[model samples]
Target chain A: MLYLVGLGLHDEKDVTVRGMEAIKGSERVYLEAYTSILGVGKERLDAFYGKDIVVADRDMVEMDSDEILRDADKVDVAFLVVGDPFGATTHADLLLRADALSIPYTVIHNASVMNAVGALGLALYNYGQTVSIPFFTDSWRPDSWLERVRENMRLGLHTLCLLDIKVKEQSEENLARGRKIYEPPRYMSVPTAISQLLSLLEDSSPSASSDSSPSLASADSLDPSTTLAISASRVGAPSQRFVAGTLAELSELDEEAFGGPLHSFVIVGRRFHALERDFAGRWAVDRERWNEVSNTVYAVRD
Target chain B: MLYLVGLGLHDEKDVTVRGMEAIKGSERVYLEAYTSILGVGKERLDAFYGKDIVVADRDMVEMDSDEILRDADKVDVAFLVVGDPFGATTHADLLLRADALSIPYTVIHNASVMNAVGALGLALYNYGQTVSIPFFTDSWRPDSWLERVRENMRLGLHTLCLLDIKVKEQSEENLARGRKIYEPPRYMSVPTAISQLLSLLEDSSPSASSDSSPSLASADSLDPSTTLAISASRVGAPSQRFVAGTLAELSELDEEAFGGPLHSFVIVGRRFHALERDFAGRWAVDRERWNEVSNTVYAVRD
Candidate 1:
């Protein structure tokens, strides 16, 4: 049996009792490390579970999954993911491989950013298609996510933007030289995500547009200064912090304002319920501004 | 301090170690009983946690919230939720009340239906706004959710329909007589939700249309016979089951096929990715029909 367990957001202790039991019964345990990171290290998890874990990077999981699933038909092989097993499509592929090999599997679910974002006081049901913001390179700036956010905004639906995390990424120079070296892991901070969003807005604004780059339609719906937004850092952790304000204000925030990495951003929709607005106001960067925009721009659905 | 801990979908063992620690340290432990239910009963949780829990029904949580928050400012109090603490808006209100009483609080996240639905091989990001399906009555047959589902289908995004669960509900006769009598709890089954959905389609169809009830726009996007759907039961439990098929076929399924209550329905959107289609095929009621619909109706985005 292949046991896919989720180490819910936070430290080693966040794993459910069932997940712990599964780990204890497993002969070999593999921790999926590329997708997301837990608050604590492998040492803490090892000490807590009394089992040594083998870290599975993207290459190993994608290319050498058979090794991970080896003898699973006869023995229990535990594969641990930072969030829920199904949070990423990559894990689904692994499950498919297990199916093809006729290896039975059990999924132990846990909280991921998809539901943990509810901690910000936004109703989960009100959220539309979630978008992911990747680390933009100088030459490879992708603004397609902006269109998704705009579509969500047009429908009066909230948008949860999952910031990118680059783990064990090979640099261009290292790849070119065929070196087996990796750059340090980089997790996008809330401020960095806001900066990228602001950059996208500027690049698509009519004032900054050239003939080569057409201006985006309905771009005004996501004005940085007026649109209400929320930034969450280290969600589901003891030190989790949520800051609500305009995108421009959030962009100006420093790491001191929101400690740690693994941040997420939410663009509040126009159809904000009165209760939602009230709950979100507790974390506002500027209380008066939050009220003004919420009252004037947003349509209260209550 | 007030601790809002999520008891992830399942039995007593599904609670995280952190949540257990909180419950152990808590002077008063309150299990939220109205929003959703765990697979196990209070006695099992009491034995596991070694603490007798005070079940907080709707009235206790809503009308008498102050009673729940009493003395939280001085001693530790844990409020347990079946899924994620923030899955329901009512919990947010409790937190707000806590804030009003100057009680600092912490949230322990866990898997909710919103994220657990991903186990059905659909990406969480692909889902749009979620809709709730209530147990329809002769006079109170609300069909506003059909429009929301239609809107999601129009945007090619999956819609997760949360079936309503009625707990401690009073019948109209009992309420009218000012009696404290309560009706037995009723949970909407998968088939009931599908039946209601099909009824909505028929009610809005041109053939069944009347002058009083106007036809819905873009109703064809959610055809019962062709549109793909997935039904999930006892999700996150060891006995969790998922069945995928057309809405019509799923509606005809009996309780034996899907063993328990607390069922959720998903209406697949047209923008189904190739990988999602392939994964969903594993649970299809009719493999040939699933493939034909995938090829003809759903736009494959690879």
Candidate 2:
């Protein structure tokens, strides 16, 4: 049997109880590393899971998935994922391979970013289209995500903007020369995403499809000074924090003590329930208005 | 402090290790029973969690939130939710309430059906609008969700059709008599959902806009079959199963065995991914023939 277990977003503890049992019961366990990540390191995961795990990088997974599944035909092998197994397409490939080989496989689900965005108090249902804001570059920067964001804003829905994370990615020279040179891994911050979004929205003004432009098409709509929430969640851990504020305010909301790798950002779009608006309020526009807005946003009947 | 933790989709083992810790540490732990439910009963959940838990129904959460938050100011309190904390807006209301009352709060994230759909090998980036299909009565059959599905299908984007679950809902008679009588909950299955979708599609043929739809017309090209995959995922535990079939074949597959509540359906209106298609090959289809069709509809590979 091949087991795909989700470790969730934070530290070792983020693994579901069943996921832990699966890990302990597996003949061999592999933790796929490239797709998503836990806030805590491997050592912490190892201690909490009570088992040693081989960290599988891109090469190990894409090239060596067969090796991982080879023994599944014999006994159980559970592969750990930082979030739910199907959270990314790579794991789905692993499942497809297992199916093709006629290996009995089971998936152990855990929390992933899809539902975790609820921490920001946006109704998951009200979220229109989710878009990814890739790391910007002088040459490869793309403005496609802007159009999706506009669609959500036009319909008064929220957009969960997943920031880009480049992990253990090899540079062109390294791959060509067969050397070990690599670019440093980077996780996109909310402020950086907001800035990129601003540039993209501004870009849409000149030669865009006239009919598709947002009614709230001004530069202010993309401004970081506008209200938004940034959740620097250490999901698998106990100290997970979801701080809300205007994009500019959260950028200044104390550089986060979230304490490890694997961070994503949520940029709030318009339209919400009074209750949802309340959750968004807790992040506070500024320290000065923190108490008042916090009350107004959260002051549902309770 | 008040902590809201998502218990994921299936059983007790679905709760994240972080969520378990919060429950273990809390002076009071309550399971919110209205929005969604775990696959098992409270006793099963308690046995798996190693603690006795109080089930908090909608009345307890919506009407008695102050009582719950009031205690949080003095001692730790943990409120459990199905899926992720914010998957339902009620938890958001609780979080904002906790924030307003100066009760420090933390949200532990989990995987809900939102991202788990990726498990079916659909590109998350390509899903457009998400619509919910609510249960209908003879007098009040609603077709609004059909419109949203059509719109999303037109855009060549996939639509995540969230099946409705009516929990602790009152009966029409109960409402009329001012009684608090409750009705049994209903969770729409994929078979049931597809029944509705096919009926709507065939019935709305004349009035339905597929070719001129924004999602469909704007796409460079799209395949009707390759464009969609319907999934019935019983996520959460190791025994979870996902069946990937076309909307047509789904109604004929084994539905009861998909097992448990919190099931969701996807209407693959339009969307394609190179890797997603590659991964989708092994799921409930003939590989030799699927490959021939896959080549035609897949996104251009990187």
Candidate 3:
């Protein structure tokens, strides 16, 4: 049997009880590393599981999936994922291949950001098309993500904006040279994302730059500063931290002392359910933070 | 302190390790009974936790939220929810109320359909505006959901069509009579959802219904019966069972054989990674299962 387990959004212990059992029962355990990583390192999970793990990066999972599934018919094999096994499509592929090979398999689910975003207090039902805002460079920035966000906001729906993470990414030169070298891993911060969002909105719509605008970009529905709530959550951990604030304030905000890799952002949309607004207010305690948040516009409400 | 914890997708054991701790630590543990239900009854969770759980319906959480948080200032309290803590907007309201009352709050995350739709083998990043497909009525059926699906297919993005559940829903007649009775809960099945999708597609594009015209649904992108998969997953449980097949096959599927209630369906979109396709293929042995997936026209085709 081949088991695909979701380790959830935080550390090693985030694995479901069932997932842990599957790992313990499996003859081979592999942690797919590239698509997503646990907030804590693999060693932590290894320590918890009391087993040596084979870390499968993109190349191994994508390029060598068949080899990974070998002999699954002979004994139990477990493939561990950072979040729910299905949170990422790569595992689904592995499952499909297992099926093709007629290998029996089961999936163990776990907490992931899709539902975890509620930490900032947004309704999952009210959330619309989720978009990823990738880190942009001088030459290759994409704005289609903005269009999607605009569409989501137009419907009074909340948007969960996933920031880009470049892991083991090869620079163009390195790729062309066929070098094995990789660029440093980059996890986009809520603040950096906000700065880019502001610039892009300003560049797309001239009116957005006006002084009278209530800190909302061109697609303002609520004052962006007042509506945005960010959580620097290292979820699935005992010490997981979640601090909310507007995007503008979040940009200037610095306190994720939550150790290492993987952080995403949420762009709070308009249409408060009373509770959403209330949950968001919890993060705006300090006067300086309040001032920072006050500078954003949610939608360009007429 | 008030903690809103998601019990996760299926049952009592679905509760995360953190959520379990919160339940054990809370002075009051209230399970919101309206938005959704776990696979098991409150008694089961109570037995597992060795504590009594108060079931909070709409009245208590909304009209009398102050009562729930009243003691939070002086005690640790938890509002338990099925799925992720903020999976529903109602919890957000509860959190907001707590914040207003000066109660510190926290959210514990868990797996939910929002992320679990990958069960059908679509890339999470490739899914476009998710829309709920409500069970149609004799008079109130709306095809509006088709637009979102079409838009997603256009962009080659998968559409995670969240099947609507009517829990604690008021009936028009009951409301008119000032009665407080709720209609029975409903969970949509794949065959039914497919029927709705086919009807709406044919209705909107009548010209495409020529005798020999492709089934209005194409299999060029994926083999529906082979690629399409259905999961009657009683997730977060020991006996969870998931099956994949053509809408026609799964529609006729006996989920009782799979396990129990709270089943969801995924309408596969065109854009899929090679791995995703392979993984989704594992769920079903039929090609038509995969053929059911359509490419949304509005997505960025990335």
lDDT of 2 by residue, B1-302 (tens): 88888887778777777788888888888888876767778998888767788888878888889877877887988888887776655465666667678898877777777776667767676676677888777777689877666556555667787788888788889999989988888888877777776666556565343445322333322223343455655655445566555454566665674666567776654356556656665565455544444454433343
Assess the local accuracy of residue A18 in candidate 3 as a C-alpha lDDT between 0 and 100. 64
Residue-level error in angstroms, candidate 3, position A140 = 4.0
| Candidate with best DockQ | 1
Q: DockQ (Cα-based) per candidate?
A: 0.67, 0.54, 0.44
DockQ, structure candidate 3: 0.44
Clashing pairs in 1: none
Relative to the unseen true structure, what is the C-alpha lDDT of residue B272 in candidate 2, on a scale of 0 to 100?
62
**What value does the lDDT take at residue A95 in candidate 3?**
66
What overall lDDT goes with each candidate model? 0.86, 0.68, 0.67
Order of candidates by lDDT, top first? 1, 2, 3
Better of 1 and 3 by DockQ: 1
- Interface RMSD (Å), each candidate? 1.3, 2.3, 2.7
Point out the higher-scoring one by lDDT: 2 or 3: 2
A86-167 per-residue lDDT for model 2 (tens digits) = 6654466677788789998877777777667666656676666677878888688887777777666555556777778888
Model 3 Cα shift for residue A242 (angstroms): 5.5
Q: lDDT tens string, model 1, A161-264?
A: 99899999899999999898999999998888888887887877765333332113243357776778998889888788899998878888897898988888
Q: How do the residues B1-302 of candidate 3 rate in per-residue lDDT, one tens digit apiece?
A: 88878787766766766678778999888888876667788999899877799999888888988878878988998888887765545466666567668888776777776776666556676666667788888887687877666555555555666666677788999999989998877776555666676666556666543444233444322222322435645555556555665545665655464555565666555555445544455556364434334222212122
Q: Write the per-residue lDDT of candidate 3 for residues A163-187, one digit (tens) a residue.
A: 7878899998999999999988888
